[model samples]
Target chain A: MSRPLLVILLSIAGAGSIVLALVVGTYPISVLQVIETIVAPAPGVVHDVVWQLRAPRVLAAFACGGLLALAGALLQVLLRNALADPYVLGVSGGAALGALVAMLLGAGDTGVSFLALAGALGSIVVVFGLTFRGGDWNVYRLLLTGVVLSAGLSACVSLILVLAPQAQVKGMLFWLMGDLAYAGSPVYAWLILAVLTALAVAQGIRLDLLAAGELKALSLGVAVTPLKLAVFFGAALATAAAVTLGGAIGFVGLMAAHAVRLLGVSHHRALLPLAVLLGGSLITLADTAARTAWAPQQLPVGVLIALVGVPAMLWLLGRRN
Target chain B: MPGVLSCRHLRLQVPGRMLCGDVSVTFEPGQMWAILGRNGCGKTTLVHALAGLDRAAGAAVELDGVVLANTPRRRRARDVGVLLQQEETEFWGSVLDYVLLGRFPHADSWTGFSREDETRATQALETVELAPLSARRYVSLSGGERQRARIAQLLAQDPRAFLLDEPLQHLDLQHQARVLARFQQLVRDERRLVAMVLHDALWPGRYCTHALLIYDGGALASGASREVLTRANLERLYAAPLAEVSYDGGSYFVPHV
Candidate 1:
């Protein structure tokens, strides 16, 4: 009975996203008009502006946001630490390093994507390599190693920024901040497909099995090494894809997962998929705020996540305590 | 229905010190046995080696007449239950969930809790009289309740043999009586083997079918519990006199004050 209640509430919340997205700009469009614009046509620039400019961006926001949140949830379980975030395990630092090097080399957008991905993959592998004991990596050790690796990668990034040409630094700076501007149809299609696939794999009570101690889980016949590898690789690939598209939009992963738990649900089977959807929605909301909070000069969408997510997470963890 | 387990030429050491080496022992099934030793005398170290939870030198731990590999012996874990001291606080789960972990060696990946699994888990909890507190968080359990839950988990495992380290640790007089009574019933009714490490000499003499006394990393004596648990031997083990006392249908020993 209670399970069904969460499902229904989520459906209603899904409908609300359209209204919230359409109604929030300067020269705001009404929900009725936005619906009509979708169904029919306004015949001029509003049609192009609404459909072309805002709609694609909204979907992209949700996609990347949800991806980050799901990644956070998975990493938390795989690492066996409740405080784990998507970027905490050096995943983000590696991506940033990849994107920065690519930019400096003048490898445009595709190069940016590939390098960021390579960085994320490398960092995840490195953390796993350094910390693995027996068939598993202890979360506390992984976290410590990650924090150290991330700091090292970050320092390298700063060194590159200092040494690089001015033009390269500007491009690197933007990629580091992750804007929702360039994400159009092709990026959205590829990104959403990969994310949904990873989400489908991560969603289940099997995730609860990760909460079981390693010895107990092993005794239960869990192929522990392969399971950890699957989770780690899946979450890392999805996260790298997000960084490839959205940059280092901090706290979306942390907030989205934390928010769902704060809403009085702890079961990962329910929390994960919802975290994906709610994560997407939250990032979309942050993107919306980033757009509307200033007229033309825009804030990095990552800033809005920090602003909203910090208080929200603290409140959630506090309330739980 | 007796199962034979024998260890031969076993050795364990750390750097310049030898904890236990060139030692051999065996116990037949359907009998209760006790291992007694001094502090840092390799009692726990020996328990871990015998349970296959730790590696040993020059010996292999065999179960049911087969020499199982260390990794695959986890499959054999369903037959051997162990209650290491203070294992609960290191992890999180409910009392019910903690006991349910006993059934894991039978499970595969899916985390499925079948009806039979729950039934066995419930029966085990009932044996320890912890059924009413099944829903309580594991951390919230009292010292006695935690001990009861651990024993219930061991019972639920339906192990062929039980290997327990400090099995009577962290219980008051009343709770200790309850646990020991259950232990006695298990040995008498089920006629299964139990190898437990006991700090107290009285319980072993009253409950154990066989006893082995160890001090300074060597066996002092071992035989039928009554013969092995004598005051003279206890005095030798503890290096002091112990006042032996007789109480209602049971015998106890204490310091003469």
Candidate 2:
């Protein structure tokens, strides 16, 4: 398929998923009601359900998905590893530990989000400091550092989970598994996604060159050190924003970029937008299914995404080869 | 449009092994230099240092009488083009797109490459005889084809000086001669500076104006091709006896078993 056609289809799917999320909730609102609520706002049960409750959740899911996938794409390039994801740098592990500790401390939802963001930022700074020691961008060292830190953080998270009270343990687990129950607003998520996406697209050509190889990129006139720094920080910030908003969601980051590439779009110029759209749509639909799959007993959206995304990605990759 | 890429009192080493000792050379326009050395003698290392991608304990390289280290990466790239010996690339772009990346130094950073850049890339592919495979994935190409693709990228770069590491690694004899002839034409017609690390002695003697022989033990010899590429010097450089044969008014060295 042509690039524009694929982009159009992904956009349509994204729009459709948002509408599906609004209409398929426990309230049993019709699609038309969801459309009417969006097109012409009025103070009614449909408006209250669609605008007040589902809008923020759906938008947050989309933004979080976009952010994670974008981060994943950038990290894949920076580390030059195909399996590199947003959380490979231990950012999400740090965020998970923070959110769980907040729960253990009897903190509110706001406190959990704040601490998660803080933890993610801390991870970003520390990893960057250690990886860039002696002012060199060593790809293998960065990967090793991130993996070791992630393992350490995950162990701490497990310790906290084991020590927490039974009542708070469930909430902690929900956060760790990624829940959108208290994602009050997606303003920060959208802001980070928009700014990062624009910046990434603007540097798309350079990113493409960087993917070729660092020495090759430098020889071709790229400021490789600065570009690598920018990519690392940009991916970190995107991951931090997503973790703060939607907990430690998985699969979207790893799979979305791969999906876009499997569909024959590899250039960053085309890859970034299509991956963002596909990721947003995938998570929006997955969240919708998570909420309504077993009505009144919501499954963790992260679990649903992994369960669906793994097989889909495997099939896509398997078919390609 | 032409400039000198010269290094002053440069020391190149790899850990405990010294590649070269305080080697100073000036590569002027209209000069095609062939760097000959045995394996693991740091021929590639010297190229990297000259390209300003690496700096050992020594004076910095200078391009057009300006310090290369202080030059901005984009500006330096517009002036010098380097072809690395080995590639650790995960690039999934088409060959045409891969070649077009060479035009990046000239690109308008925000808007990407121009139509003229595309034309240059396509023409480069045509020059390398990879035009038919322009749409193929770069990684999917054969070894020789990928080497040609890299050469195409360097051609598209169109820098004043070309520093190529082992430019004929995977080429067949036909391609080997053709690529050398192309670089020879580039130097003769465009007055570009060409410096390449070559394993074979025949092509350099045929095509190059000057030769820099980097022996293994921190020894260096560089001057006119005829002066530096003697059978005595080459046999010592490789630690193997060689038989010199003159064919078509060109001297060729063959290793003696």
DockQ of each: 0.21, 0.81
Residues B234-254 of candidate 2: C-alpha lDDT, one tens digit per residue: 889888888888899788898
Q: Enumerate residue pairs that collide in model 1.
A: A66-A280
Please identify model 2 stretches exceeding 4 Å from their true place. Answer: B55-59
Clashing pairs in 2: none
By TM-score, who's the top model here?
2
lDDT of 1 by residue, A261-303 (tens): 6574555657777777677777778888888889677767887
Q: Write the per-residue lDDT of candidate 1 for residues B1-257, one digit (tens) a residue.
A: 55565566666556588876655777667778888877777776666666665543424656666653343644657666666654512334457777777776664535455788889999999988899999766767888778888888878877767788887888788778887787777777887778889898677877788887776756547678778787888888877778988877656677555
- Residue-level lDDT for A159 in candidate 1: 98
